[model samples]
Target: MSFDQLASELVSRKRADLYRERRVLESPQQPEVVVDGKAYLAFCSNDYLGLANHPDLIRAFQQAADEYGVGGGASHLVSGHSFHHHALEEELADFTGRPRALLFSNGYMANMGTVNALVGKQDAVFEDRLNHASLLDAGLLSGARFQRYLHNSPESLAQKLEKTEARRKLVVTDGVFSMDGDVADMPAICHTAKVNDAWVMVDDAHGFGCIGATGAGVAEHYGLSVDDLPVLMGTLGKAFGTSGAFVAGSETLIETLIQQARTYIYTTSMPPAVAAATRASLKLVIAEQWRRELLKSLIQRFRDGCQQLGLTLMDSPTPIQPILIGDSAKAMTMSAALREQGIFITAIRPPTVPQGSARLRVTLSAAHSEAQVDRLLDALERVK
Candidate 1:
């Protein structure tokens, strides 16, 4: 808590090349952006289906603002639950094939609130080693006996769950590993959870608007149902191209969260206009199948190009492709070099990733053309 110690810690981080900073984005979230007064072709956004700045979404937001004003003035438990929020929740439930869906302020709050609501001191919370920070933090903050298994390994999960004697057991994972871009083995994980008498929770933040035949996400992509993968959480800010998150499950589960989840209970609901915008984006996510197809094509194109370049790529079929740079400084150098060439790709380092496994997280979107992807590849090759 002392000022001197904080300054020393900051100096240590800088010396270790682990200091982090944020860039000022002047433009809207899209493929092309202006960062710190410089124009660049950005590949770091989570706008997978290219709906972040879509005209339809903009119009819906504008119309909703005209009708409902801007803010949700109070918590959902108070007077903040607008018709727009209720309608979006219902639409999300239908979209995900769930019995009910409860909206939260964001993905982090949804994960934290859900885990804490379901588990307690006598319960057990198991998670993937490489899950999103939100999931990891939720598990720790739940005050349950938290344990993490190897990344995406059902066998590792089974080994840990078999010995758990808690009153309730919850196994959590990301539907699509956000950093690695690979998907969790949903069928295998669900089977393991069943054998251990534990429920499964999947946070499909990066999958919902880009995967499956109808963009139902990893659960639908693997043909898993509400019974197989119970507790589905997705973020609207990512693939949905809106802002907020939700948890979908049976009626009992959602109602339980509404009554017990502190995060949901205390936080103000998202703007009514944001919910309306999500409704519009949801329509495009389902009706405009071309976006998904285009994203798939772009992923394939980038992967094929990287393979030809012999770049170290993770086994990811999703839009979140990561190139392993191994060293943190090297990753940072590569990122700076790419920016110098008019491309913007962020270098992801520990403790976000494991030590000695720093990487360049190259994400794709439906908005990017094939030529743009090739340009990125060209820049990467030149940097190399």
Candidate 2:
């Protein structure tokens, strides 16, 4: 690999307006933020319930840090699992209505470890085409026969399931598709899997702390028990406003991951302080029904505003609302236009989305006022 080749590729990416950059955040994870020395009303965050900078979580984190120190010091199997980690896992298992739950450093590791541990050379894996990158990577690396069905289409999944003769069959999907902001058809998908004698897994990374009556995620929202969805993977970073991830499932499933999952066996545990903070976050997520209601109202208002502006949005009931723009460069330009108006929305382009389906991914939070949403709508009208 020559350096010139890399430079040429970078230049080509720039020409295509596909180059990526990071903006420096000078404030907490809130609606109003200072990025790159400029203050903007940003809508590109995943903190749906707005608990990231809450005082309770902060106090919990600080107290836990004072008691437990900062670093995990070792892998969970090698003496890193602290009281906070164990308690959080138990709390999470109860929260998700699962028999047991296992914690991982992040969602990627949780998905990778669980899938690879469950399926092997003689087994097969099926996933939705629009699943998050973590699920796709897990399926590919599981050493199982991997197949993809149509997005949220149980018929497509059934067709694939019928053709496979592997010793074990696993069906996987996102409870909530991240980029599109649409909920998966779990009732249909799970039924298809059950008839095929396949186990179902749902990565509810973007669903929890926002959906469901008590914020147990899509599983609770759809009334699916642990029997309906076996391997449940969820991330704390997004909705919980904390860091780490977990897999809630049967006792046998968790034991299998603990014994066979290479990622979990080899990796260091997350900080105890983070786990302690997540405990606080979980309490707020469950108790605050008003937060969910406010999110719904905000989403509806944004959707109605988009309709009035004739802006085509995805069929998403979640807090994620993307305005589709066909051309990548045009999408980038539109994002820049919004930034100029002191509203920060990033352009989502190819590889993240399909070619010519570039979009401006507008994520909302309960922290945002209706006036802020109106300001965004005004910016959209002007940008249009």
Candidate 3:
């Protein structure tokens, strides 16, 4: 089995500017980071609330590590479900305004597990055309009848929902679409789904810790309850500034997942220390309103600056602002150019984005000062 064809395919991707490489991160996640042995003002992090390196979260993790040790040791069904994990799930349930919440190792697993647990061959899944890869993969893996509607178009969703004759129909979407940074019209979607007798699930990975008044995420922003959005999923890594992911919903829904979701039942639970740190992170997420407020301000500041530069921006009110570059090779060049100027924003190209829509994915954070944003704007002016 010579991998000659595989090697040729890799070469083709590189020539087409589609090859992806991992940059070595040598420091903790923050506005300023050491990557590939050089310090850069990083603008591509998902740490929207800037709590990833918060002193309190760090201290809590260290303290918990002393008590619970490092690894999860076993699956949640075995000895790995520690006190911290149990407590965090309770806190998450309360935070999300759901009856119960179950934790998974990561967002991908959470999506895959929940979707598979809820629907099967006789059922169907409806999703946004622009859903995150995890949700799309989950729908495909569940062996359900999968269909995608136009992005954020509740009318399109309703049209599809009206025609599906599957046993169970689950409508899935991203609360805050990860790449474009635009939010889904959850109110309209929920209403349509309810009318059509379909279950609604929102993967709010980017919404948690960023949107909503008390950082309860998009559901809270829209005043939606468990009855409105039946399955709510969020990742701890983004706004919560830790790691792991969870699904919050009714007790029956959660227990169903616990029993049937192989991703959750068989995988090692997240480390108890991470659960402890996330508990601390959750406290900050709720108590520190100023963090979200600062994020709001920063997002506006960056957007305003981009507008002045006459740069094409997506309809995104979130911190994830993508500057449209359109050409994949040029987008890669622009990313490197910004890096040379000590500003780090990654070029997101196809198939992460559709063809002819390559972009410089500029993510803002509360940790960034207005001055740093200005520096990026200045660099963008030079590059563009």
Candidate 4:
């Protein structure tokens, strides 16, 4: 259809809600930032560790730029691969306790690359109903018989699995749901996959660098080994305080993706400086335990305060605590009300969430202080 026709159709169906406007940011990612010339306490970022503005990471990026001269200059398969990328990949392998690791330009690409490469037309892919859009899209692109289970329900997964007859069965889920902030029932899901002889993959985009023992992510959080969950995906931008993402698994898995994953082979590599900064950030994420602890405290404080206010919060123990507002208009109103008080939070509506389940995705960061959490709670109470 013509672009104008498509635009009109969108407006008619109210899918024009997809048209989001962006505000110009004039400062580093922190508790407060300058947006559209107004200073606001920003809660919309994924920088859970609050290391995006750390001086050490900044120095690491600057030093790497001085040495490597910024751009990667080519794709990973070409001349773009550098020492910074190599070192970071090795470090990530170590971080996840995997035999090898491979980097991708972003989390979306990583998910698409791994899922598409691993399973093809002959396979069947089962996913959580609320998995990230990337996973669902990847399954579609794979030409696999894609099916979805009820969110975080292993019984639902098994019922679907019982009917599938593909040559290979794959189960994928988000480690920590981005909007709901709840963790997957990994032990149950992984156990089900194991009994069915299916492969399990987890996209721990929001969990890595933020959860588990020593920040090893969801698998570690639940004490699942590489055996229980063989495929692991993590994004560096969220908590590692840098750009890009990685997949850690068996050597054969890494090599197969390197050889077969179109997304990994065709795209330009991430900046070498970013890899350097990720390395530095990884160090801090491990060495300094206070950040995670403080985040845990903040999450508890927010949840407790919300319960006291009688808000319909989701079942979440993580930092991404979303307040479920069933009406999209109400969600938007809550967002605007908070913004008026200098607090910035994004309202998530369908189809990012289900219809009639729009919400304020209140993300907490380690940079947030007790006073900041109280201020946010006070503002929410006023508007709610």
Give all TM-scores, in the order shown. Answer: 0.99, 0.99, 0.99, 0.97
Return the clash pairs for model 1, or none.
none
Clashing pairs in 4: none
Question: Measured by TM-score, how close is model 4 to the native structure?
Answer: 0.97
lDDT of 3 by residue, 1-384 (tens): 899999999999999999999999999999999999999999999999999999999999999999999999999998999999999999999998999999999999999999999999999999999999999999999999999999999999999999988999999999999999999999999999999999999999999988998988999999998999999999999988899999999999999999999999989999999999999999988889998888889889889998999999999999999999999999999999999999999999999999999999999999999899999999999999
Q: Which residue ranges in model 2 land beyond 4 Å of their true spot? A: none
Give the higher-TM-score candidate: 2 or 4: 2
For each candidate in the order shown, give its overall lDDT on alpha carbons. Answer: 0.94, 0.95, 0.95, 0.92
Model 4 worst lDDT window (10 residues): 12-21
| Residue lDDT tens for model 2, 1-384 | 569989999999999989999989999999999999999999999999999999999999999999999999999999999999999999999999999999999999999999999999999999999898988999999999999999999999999999999999999999988999999999899999999999999999999877788989999999999899888889999989999999999999999999999999999999999999999999999888899999999999999999999999999999999999889999999999999999999999988888988999999999999999999999999997
Off by over 4 Å in 1: none
Report the lDDT tens digits of candidate 4 across residue range 121-203.
99999999999999999988999999999999999999988888889999999999988999999999999999998999999
Indicate whether candidate 1 or candidate 4 has the larger lDDT. Answer: 1
Worst 10 residues of 3 by lDDT: 291-300
lDDT of 4 at 271: 91
